[model samples]
Target: MAQTGIADRAARNGHAADEGGAGLAGRLLGGLARQVQQRIPAADLDERDPDYIRESLPRQWLLASLWFRGEVRGLGNIPESGPVLLVGNHSGGNMTPDTIVFTLAFYTYFGVERPFYQLAHNLVVSFPQLSFLRKFGTVAASPENSAKALQAGAALLVYPGGDRRSLARGLGLDRLFRLKVLPISLALPWGINVGDFLGHIPLPAKITVEALPPIDLREEFGQQPDLDEVYDHVMRLMQDTLDALAAERRLPVLG
Candidate 1:
């Protein structure tokens, strides 16, 4: 209790000397976030170019088809209009083939004119080499950007992996954004790649994606349902789908 009081007082004091060495992390993360925000400004939403998407569809499709040999199903289940919350798993390190496949599928099915956005890591959006991703509606994964995309009636795709807090935030998103939670599953038979920068990647592998039926929070869960229950249900549903996908794989990347 004494230590707790000291810590509380330190926080209340808001002095670097009183931070108990907590200021380093805050400073580092803040600097990084600031640098990323500079590279990919909040106004980057306007960078979503329909013409660019239209022209790049063939290239993305070829990469998805010939390279990854990707296939997607149940995309029709998504509503034709309005905002949507696509929650799914992602793999393949920085060369995330699952996202590439899904991007092609979504653009072709919905048409380039439709507003669609994807939340990506700050590093991904901030990388100068990958700046073109912004043109494809890839925004830095932040609450403000997510809210803006939803407000713009854009379909938002999020891979809430390794972050239970993000997954739990679905409860608040449901209430505020009135967003429909669609549990999507993407399978990479190749498994995860650590994104080795020093060496070239091996031959392309197969990737399969499935968009499950949408979940209406109010209808599926009670009016004031428990967040934990919702999280468990979603997690279970995703895991089962992944297991089923894994079972079908006879080989690793060759599949």
Candidate 2:
């Protein structure tokens, strides 16, 4: 009888686990569905409709509740369609706050649930618990994954400096690396727009996002592989966007 009771308890726990898994799946699916519902037509995006605000308000509210306030400006510039590249500074600390906060802002302000598929260190995703982070759009930041996302018309966020620069032992503003250039190069030929955000200067940091004019690769690419040339072109565009935003210095800290 004691053995039977133990088995029964184990089975009950399994059922509860299954129920919890199902609930989480439902929530993620719902979030994605909401994104589709809130999508503005490619042409009508110029209107800068407030529908994005409506869809994104909940996320902002949650951020507020967490006492993790930050500003996310420059919403008017996001392209309505096609693949887009987001290159920014990476934080070396565990689970960079910049990545998470910026993602929340994008979802809340833009009404887009497309999570930033970070090109994480392979070791991070290889672990079982951390692998689940992929559902939130974490991916190995490899050339293959980058190309795949662009092909699927997904927006990608990258940190050119990697963790080393953001979490540098000694930092006096080193140059931004070009790791993201690989993804940007792939995105351009696909007519993907590139965006850059600059901000997050420590705890009391603010964010400024800027959208660069889409790299015009249709004229340059004749259905061929000119990766080096493409990389330079995309890098220049990203650099221009970041430089512009950094100059503005409009940091708005939310309470």
Candidate 3:
């Protein structure tokens, strides 16, 4: 198009209008100047990362904590070293931020160096802008990939409810949901320790990450591998854990 021609010229020239002194910033500016001289920025190319970007967690942790404005409890419950499956309820809209916050908290409080690989939706890998999100060490939640991550001894964070639970029709509803059993199935076979992290969250409110006891998968894996049966079994176990935590919260403690 005619517009594309103009933009290309500008990018080639480096917008002299904005250039002052020739330096590192000037060189960078020059590249932009060329594009602006003729065409717009969009006419140029774009780059996106498909894996987790190395970011400043110290900064992100502060920002995310403030964003959620919630308290994180039972941080000590996370194992110092070992593979873990963090199963929690997902809220509609953006569960990524929530997971990021939880991931940062674990690193900040527990000093976890092992990369935390999360299960991403298939759509994320299909879209462009969303695909950028995939860069953050997230693998699609497919049977093969999930198994590989566990086998490789990587810590996994998943919201078993998936989109249906996280993207429920209502907002600011209940935070609890049944957990998925596949993760347990995968963990037990690999002898990976599983942790049931209870995120007792009230939307537009403070967040509490109650790290519960690790769920042993040895027994569950022995059963048939039918996904339906696995899902049901995991759901019951997760619900029981959540209920127990709720009861504990209700109890009065004497020091």
Candidate 4:
């Protein structure tokens, strides 16, 4: 009966299962079954699975507390309820330990039940082991996705550096002013700088992440809205905060 149910699910997902196999071939077929499961769009991910997140929280907490030693500030600026956009710089290349640290901290502080989502690149979403990301409320970065998440009254986290070309075009005025922009930073004391372009292993780094006050487009920019002005204001605020944090760091990775 259980085997029948598995076969039915595979058929519904447009994947055919091989019933006949043994040893290496059976193992290969089992691997394919798992891949098919990952590819199936079981849910639209409009809201996160709080139970799944709760189940996974302990491991994430351990990493955040012991491995990264992450500290988050200005969380009070985040409203207890309502939609808000969190914009931050991207650091530490492909591995992006900073994102992991911030995310775990955010969920811990707010509890897993809160409707929160993080925008990520499609590559990251499609990558292996990251399939669980969707369950934890990560969506591929897109204008439509962003609008949908906000409309649902969920807090959204976005990294401008994650999409450099779009960010550059949108914030061209900042470049013209030669503004110092810092989106995200990771301090590694072990001297293992695992940048995206460099490698994958993350060293034990004391990560500190801060969340700025929420910005309401309708309230701050009015109904009409000034895109250029809004862009400049956000970048400047982030840059100022980055400068302050940098000042406090006496050495690399020690902060």
Query: What are the models' TM-scores?
Result: 0.78, 0.47, 0.50, 0.69
Q: Which consecutive 10 residues in model 2 have the weakest lDDT in total?
A: 185-194
- Deviation of model 1 at 212, angstroms: 0.3
lDDT of each: 0.69, 0.46, 0.46, 0.64
* CA displacement after TM-score superposition, residue 220 of candidate 2 (Å): 5.4
Model 2 stretches with alpha carbons more than 4 Å out: 1-69, 91-94, 109-116, 126-132, 162-202, 220-237, 240-244, 247-255
**Which regions of candidate 3 deviate over 4 angstroms?**
1-55, 94-96, 110-112, 125-132, 162-203, 219-233, 240-255
- Residues 1-255 of candidate 3 have per-residue lDDT tens digits of 654454445456654333344443555555564544333111101122212243555666677556555345565555555556666654334334556556666556654346556666654444565554445456555434544554555566666554533322111111111222222211100001122223433233334455555554435444333444545665665566555544544222200
Best-to-worst ranking by TM-score:
1, 4, 3, 2
RMSD each, Å: 5.4, 16.6, 17.7, 13.1
Judging by lDDT, tell me the better candidate of 1 and 4. Answer: 1
Candidate 2 residue-wise lDDT, 1-255, digit = tens: 643443344445452222466655544455454454344222111222235544655765575335444445554455655566665554344445555565656666555444335555555555676544455566655555655555556666666553433322111111112222222321110011122223322343443344444443434553343545655555667666555655555444321
Q: Looking at model 4, which ten-residue stretch has the lowest summed lDDT?
A: 182-191
